[model samples]
Target: MMASQRGDVSAVRALFVSQRASPYDVTPSNCGPLRFAIESGSLELVQFLCHNGADVNTTFGTFETSPLEWAYKTRQIEIARFFLRQGARLDYLCFRGWTPVVLLFQESSPTVPLEFFGLLSGHSFSDFDVQDRFGVTALHRAARWGSVGDVHALLQLGASPTLTDNEQRWTAAFWAASANNVATLKRLTEGAPSNFIDHVDFRGWSILHVAIEAGGLETMCLVLELGVDPHQTIMVESEDSCVMEELTATEFARTKGQATYRCFTQALQLTGYNISVIEDSDTELVFWDT
Candidate 1:
């Protein structure tokens, strides 16, 4: 901790040299010199630890997390690459809800090693898109909270937008829609399903319905451009438990919880609030997850 905090690479080097027994130990919370350096953005210290025989691929403790994952997650993309070239596997999925890609994209603009990110680009995978405990993919996180830079990095790394999570639902398209990021959504759906936008959750609403209900005009327009029919009809069960003609986006959402009718009802007029998706159904009223 002292050496890491002070950025004393020399003392750290002498203490952990391979020739020594090494009184200090590496750990997760109290990461050894390398992790601490990565954590603190001390590239100098990181270089020292690596030169002194720190295992670049070592999992600190909890989550089986490696130095590469931390470096990626905390904006040390270069450091992550250094670890990877030293024998870290870029695709290794740990117990935590993260792969190196997840770590790379979680921040506004995560650290992306140019050569490494470039190396993973131009790749493709039918089954490599893995999800963590929440059933979210690296693509999901990037399109949701990441910058265009991060988006481009993962895209180059060959993350599959079509990959689904554990729920057997939610593609990268759904996540982009929910995030209201039209640009990223456009990039992620290049070769997806024709009715991909029409994919309803356990419920019967499609992605367009979600955007419309959420008042995401940009997202709605993008989906429409991607082939979502704006005038599609959706069945809604009224408060009286009776089926009704729900035209426009708000009604469909209100009845089914798209955009809370009561919560944002006051500003419902924002997106032609009164208008909603038209309705039609077999019979029984049921809630669907989108």
Candidate 2:
């Protein structure tokens, strides 16, 4: 395992030959030799292990991640492609319901090959909307990270923007709302049905509410222009640590906006007005006084 982890192809080969070590043995660490080789980013060692009957589909750790997932996590594009050619499942779920595609987007680096994404997209079993244990899909991950390109790619691969995660039932739009990612939200809304953007969480926090509290005035304006109701309200609990309060989106925005700046009130008024009035105005509106 140490040899493989160190990318020591020759040493691994020598140890394997001398000890008759089986590459298929899953160690107590929940990581197999092939998975270790993958973590080393050594293409040669990985190929050798696979040739020696290393199970590319073997899952380990709490996430049940396969070698293909390890490849994606390690940015081992060639190894990833090799595993795919060897019949690795495209939508294999790892820890927390994360598929390789979902995990790929979770990577902090941006240099991953487009071909890899394309390969996963081309796979017949690639379930674009496959959710994690949290019910968060690739779209949710991409939206949370502000990964616009990956969000677009996932959508093109037939990922549904309407699907929501388990707990909050927050759609991709809602994820974008929480993250204040207007560009990603716009991409998601493109060609969507007129009413598609009108959803809220299980708590009844409207898209307008989310946009206003987490997003700035521009985002609030965008959501309203996209046809969200500014008058939307949800009954939220805990006014005095135990009481419930029903607040309109406008009022909620004002309350939340006060913590950051005084300008959120203006945002509420702009959207809270009759939609007809906003549409009729030719003058540009400023949300804040600089």
Candidate 3:
């Protein structure tokens, strides 16, 4: 990105023209002129970095965060596009996180530029298969960060909100409501399958548990209107999900490794809206959020 930022044609030319037969290491710590230029929004420098052997996918630090993450967090869509053009990988899996796409969703962010969207539209992010250390998905990231635009973009680009992380876990809907994103929640619920209302995690957490933790009335109402169980259990059942226990031939294709999906409907039938009893019962409803 720095190389692109710098707009140094020579630098760009030099990077791709490596004489060595091997690839140059562009780790974040070792990044030079390109990193500096990218951080400073020097498109010329970023161009140079991409042209040279500066990695479009380079993570500046060993923290697993990448320059692309920085670009998204800063809403520097131009810089992000430059990297994408240079072949940076978008969408990560089997990891904790690549960068902070969530920051893009915040209400506090500046108006995102159209160039970023154009670039994003042109590329296919690998978020569908990407997972974080906790088995969280890019959808989870969008939900946690409340980046509905990003979520919509990802969905439009073929990401599955139904996918589970490494843990076979939460849906994008769960995370969205947890982060108090009413719009995201509405979209998720309105478009989800019938069983989603009863979906529970291994710990048996319906999306409502997550939403109450966030404590927004609109979020709660949105979730409620969508029909999640007010009395859903948080403790995951220590058995295979009933949804997938049937014969393989009968089972339609599902997100790999996800025993859990949206089932708030079942959970609601199991536990009606009775927060007071849960608030009073010490052991029976001990998992209740205080």
lDDT of 1: 0.62
Quote the lDDT for 189 in model 1.
73
Task: Give per-residue CA lDDT, model 3, range 1-290, as digits (tens).
Answer: 34434555565556656642112445446544454565666676566556656676765554545667767766667787777766677664113454344434444554445455556556744444355566665566665565556567656656677866556477888778766878766766656788887877665566666655555556656667776655443432224664423222101111212221113222322444332223344322223334
TM-score of 3: 0.60
lDDT of 3 at 168: 41
TM-score of each: 0.70, 0.84, 0.60
Candidate 1 lDDT, 1-290, residue by residue in tens? 56675767766667666544242465447456666678777777777777766777777656777788787667665676567668766666678756665666654564445554553442322222668897888777777766556566666656666666566377777777777877777777766766577677545567777665556656766766676654567766666757565655444545545445433333333434343333458332222223
Instruction: List CA RMSD, all candidates.
Output: 7.2, 5.8, 10.8
- List residue ranges in candidate 2 displaced over 4 A: 107-112, 215-217, 261-263, 266-290
- Best model per lDDT: 2
Per-residue accuracy of model 2 over 30-137 as CA lDDT, tens digit each: 777887888888899988888877878888876788888778777788898889888887756776777787766653556346776787766765687887778888
Cand. 2 TM to true fold: 0.84
Candidate 1 regions exceeding 4 Å error are 11-30, 110-116, 119-128, 148-157, 230-248, 253-290
Candidate 3's C-alpha runs over 4 A off are 1-29, 48-59, 64-73, 84-114, 124-129, 166-168, 231-290
